[model samples]
Target: MSSADSTDAPIYAGLVEEQGDVLAEVRRVAEEVLRDADRAIDFGGVRSSAAYR
Candidate 1:
């Protein structure tokens, strides 16, 4: 099947992240993992907020 054919597919993904016991850091770790996985992408820089007009 073509990639687009799977567009409606659903995934069962989850994270078993725990800290200090796991730092319990949620967004931080997720973003780090995303960056590592997409090393070719330059996320530019941290953005606080954006406005579209």
Candidate 2:
């Protein structure tokens, strides 16, 4: 959904490129995959999900 801004850049210049890719992937998963599941867990409880078994 939302893209990272320049201010979101990592502190270590050497790791900037690598960390940026990693951060993007992590954010993508959070917004796409985990978003709904996170809400479900908060409302229904983690044990209610069959995947948690």
Identify the candidate with maximal lDDT: 2
**What's every prediction's RMSD, in angstroms?**
14.4, 10.6
- For candidate 2, write residues 1-53 as lDDT tens digits: 24465545444454765455676778898898777886666755555786677
For candidate 1, the 10 contiguous residues with the lowest summed lDDT are 12-21
Give candidate 2's error at residue 2 in angstroms: 24
Among residues 3 or more apart in sequence or in different chains, the pairs in candidate 1 whose N, CA or C atoms overlap within 3 Å are 18-22, 19-22, 19-23, 20-23
Query: Model 2 lDDT vs. the true structure?
Result: 0.64
lDDT tens digits, residues 1-53, model 1?
A: 78865653332111232213233467679889988889876545534233322
